[model samples]
Target: MGASFEQRPQPWVTNISIDDIHSRDFLAISKIHGRWGGFETLEKWVCGAYAGYTAVCLRDSEGKLWVGESRHDNEQGAGATEVQYSNGDNAIFVLFLSLRGEDVIAVLPWDEWWEFELNKDDSNPHIALLPLHPDMRAKFNETAAWKYAQSMNGKPYGYHNMLFSWIGTINANYPPLLDAHVVASVMTVCNQMQPAYAANMWNEALNKRLGTEVPSYSICNCLAWDLPDLIVKTEMRGSSFAELLTIPEQDDWVYSDGRSASCVAFVLEIYKAARLFDPISRSIQVTEFTIKDAYSLRFFENNSSRLPKWCNDGDDVEFLFCQIRGRYRMELPGYNTMDPYPHMNEMCPSLPPKYSRPSNCLKAFPMM
Candidate 1:
């Protein structure tokens, strides 16, 4: 019998490594600058983002998993600019190509991913891209997560749920697939200075109740007024986002109401559906630095001096970079601005009319 999207298989408890996927002679990509361009090419093609993302995972002979993040190593040297595009997709795609049918059915130890170091190097934070075993891929392919993600193949893309979905599937105890309005509400809580104002207005107008405080810096997306209810409904139905995915009319929940998914959310949903990590655990064993290393979206923007007081604490520089890079060309495009004044405030709408600038963009970055 063929496996359907809603099916959840028994967890494959066996642990595997990148070395197991590659031959004993395989070397880390960092050691070979000549090959970097090849990876960059693949990223430009598959990533489909103005700014790229980078994550690399390798396991040494000792079996210790070492991860690497894409750093800005352009003509200006390191930290001079933020990495606009990541080569992690290239690493993953290459690994998938290299593995033969013999490498199927294996699973990664779930704990390791959550436990990876963010600041592996004091100078540069890097998270390695760990490829899922063919078996795990097959396993994930049988799930609703996979089916729902696949349902979004060629739709118009939006940036709202991408970061939040990644954080939710990998970190939250349950799936964080929420409606766009819910996500907007969550963004309001995190982005507004008088956080209660937005929540109060939403409650009054929509006749709904939402959380007042930002629950965690870890949470980056919008949460529904009744997220717990949606989660419970999912548990009863056996799939979280599948129902939302099946909305055939191209409603407001999907980006552009075109019934599409963003690239990052699609990939992470594959990971979640594959059961790459324990969804129920939500332990988050990794350090603060490690989580930061793993994600491109800024989780520490609350601590950033460049952000305005009304901006979301979880707003990421990469998210802002994507917004800026998407529009309004800069002379030195690669230059990273420390003060995100006009651009920073442009994307946010949670702020009241008093806080809003002349340009009224309703969307903002995820909180985490």
Candidate 2:
């Protein structure tokens, strides 16, 4: 029910140097095409197309991965940020925050996220403040950027709703205009870096390599390979056996129509992309994969790996999963709403210690 791409031999697979760690030439573009709806509408049609949604994840000078979505969320809706932070269940820090949740673009910081805000200004309307560890706030002034950020309290957060079809000298009340433009431009450039191939070609290759019965859910899994490779092209996310799923797209992990997980698909995807010659067959095996023994196929092994816990205090995916899957709902650590940020919120203690304390695990005292 959408546009299709052609599959061609990605000859560039041979050109990539697995040993080259610092090469900036290798860019990863993950096109998340889902049913968001509105690709082709007439008469002042807003770009809010459910035709699909796209997100381009790129790394910055600081080594932080910035994921920028194509569309902006509601001004009052907390869903995007809720999903972004996931109340600290997902190990990501929301670099961009605003009253309206205008953070179409979010930065997943390498270091722990602490509390701070660099208020809105003319150039950037969305608020830049976020929760940081209390101890780090004082040392924040040490940086020139921090000093300037703190000073941005008074400027108006300008916004402009931009569309490629439309031309303008329109006023700048639409802050998304700037945000969307920057993200779109960067995605365009990243996309251009890839060898010219139809989108369906990539999808077909991905499905064939993974032996996936359903490629739609598995396509999102490529982000596991795409993001980490772009981060350090030399290494894969987990390894040949395991990989890290950094982006927690609801479609891939949560929602499903009884599809198998996509871990083995990642192994094959990376194996072919890196152009490794199979020793036994002595040919580059991209389309076909075989194993000598059944014991070797442990599909569930490292597949449980997720980016990091980042659920918002109130937005409980566990509850939602239960409602949808019709399973018993499991309560996660308690939400310390009092904490400035959801990440800082303490997890309620488990009845008995099984493993090391859970993230932000609360210290429960014996009955007094």
Candidate 3:
């Protein structure tokens, strides 16, 4: 299933020149409207406002534009085993290839491609973003960015920690017809059916929290006999399910397959290497950044005057980059107001008490 664009919207920007965009700029692609992978769609519905895909722009010494993205085509695939590169001839090709033809187009620095391919087709659209702060923009180390990208080039996608990254609370992360109980029940079944897979999936994380060395094949047995006691004991120790379930992501931690970094995680880790989040947000765990959280970090160029003349020409909507297609309008929600908890997501401990877990979070238990 591809994205539907029957009522194509007006192009967000006009006469965009490749010269306007610079290296280290960011791109937050919107969620594909009608894609088959329900997981990303669910992420968009839950996180809101363009929580689909993210990639970084880099330029070589000769000043050729290249995109660095952690792309996982499907479950059966090798799983983002390398940092995918998309250049002039294959940028658009890779975009469609990665996203499975979602009615989206990528903008590159190629003038001929831009003029002939994009200008000729009004239905396809693209957007661009840059650092908002002059100091941060100046501090962007293109060398460091490339180096970091190269380092993690062959690491597997962070599928193991993906759910834990967003699921800070017991209830908030689940969409309709799903909750903590439902997740736990599904996990219990998975444990019974495929203990090793389930163990690698989450039991190891649970074992880490519980200070236990329970083996993978015995996980189902432990779930049946020991998990309830562990839950009760956890409550007795003054901890809640939320805290027990919240696994802090470690950059050095190697999973069963390999070191893991999701799409947004890969982007933020590159930003960390480039010193883009220096001075204040350097210590943040990149894995914790959802697509929404990453984009809302108040780092992107928001001022229209500072942007290209074409980017600023849109009258109906103020440009924070551009959204060329989508049923709903795009917004940056907490834009420029990312105070107190700048780099962390809404579920971070640094947030105020109001952001803490609900009372029910204390009472919740994993299904047996």
Candidate 4:
């Protein structure tokens, strides 16, 4: 039987202007909720809960607004650079490579970017989130934020470590039709298609976990095996694929000859550099964050009075932020309630056979 998908309602918008977003200075965070296309739908079904695209909006000293994000252009494939809006003049260059292929990191004018994002799709909803701390604006390190952004300006999007963010457990984290076996099967196929790409993405990560330098010849030989045979061979080596996969060290991870950061990871790394998560979330790896985890952090502004005038705070809005677009009401189920779980992703496979997660770890969203 085939699965039927529900068509979500159209998104609603307010008269909110770019000025309102600029008012928050370098602290405004923009997010789009709901699927825009096949890729985003797959993302929601696989890793994400509710949110789609996320970026940091910064207003520099000269009052110029900018948007920093890690994005992929489907048409470009491995050579993809520059996200061109329907309006040709509004294009942003792709500065770095992404592990998945040629995805790039881009920083572009906020007015142009924001307008493009709002009008990109009528089906998706958007929101602008601000920091909750009253003194965040006064204490924010604009220089450091800009410096960190520039440092990662042309780095690859963290595609190699993307799965680690969602697969906290061997089976629980997987959605319908997905499991460790399916993942291994996919990896086997990928290995057959591009040995080098598979080596860089999986072999290297597995090597790090095994703590032994497995030569290229050995890895290639192992990759040539069938799915069941590969698993059996992996067991013979004394480790499961789940155990061999580890959480990536965000600041230290190097792939495709450069550093990598996914869209959410890119945003959180900027936050970490700015010291926004100081003292409490300092030990948390920014790379481990999913869109749901990033938005749930307590750093966002919750006071209704401080939000923009156009923000609809009527009884319908569940979270602190205003719904600037989309037909359905936006909700962040675990907002500000997540307690940092040290190496939570790494402990997933170690859990009891049927247990989904440890009691102390944050709960994942239900499958949609």
lDDT of 2 by residue, 149-172 (tens): 122211112111111112111221
Candidate 4, residues 1-368, lDDT tens digits: the string is 11222222343555566676742332222243443444555555565445666777766555666778776332333432332212133323223323344556766677666576578634444454544445655556656666667667656566666666666655666666777777888888888898777765665554444444334446454433333444565678766775444334445655544666778788877777776666645456777666766666666666767867756634343446756554445555455555455543333332222223344563332211
Best candidate per TM-score, number?
4
Q: Rate the local accuracy (lDDT) of all candidates.
A: 0.26, 0.22, 0.54, 0.55
**In candidate 2, residue 48 scores what lDDT?**
17
Ranked by lDDT, the better of candidates 1 and 2 is 1
RMSD of each: 22.0, 25.0, 8.5, 8.1
Model 3 residue 116 CA deviation (Å) reads: 15
- Model 1, residue 361: distance off in Å is 29
Q: What is the C-alpha local distance difference test score of candidate 1?
A: 0.26
The regions of model 2 sitting more than 4 angstroms off are: 1-4, 8-37, 40-62, 69-94, 98-103, 109-159, 164-368
Candidate 2's error at 57, in angstroms? 5.4
Could you give the candidate ranking by TM-score, starting with the highest?
4, 3, 1, 2
Quote each prediction's TM-score: 0.23, 0.19, 0.67, 0.72
Tens-digit lDDT string for candidate 1 (62-137):
3544322222122222211111111334322111111222111111222332232221212211112223333434
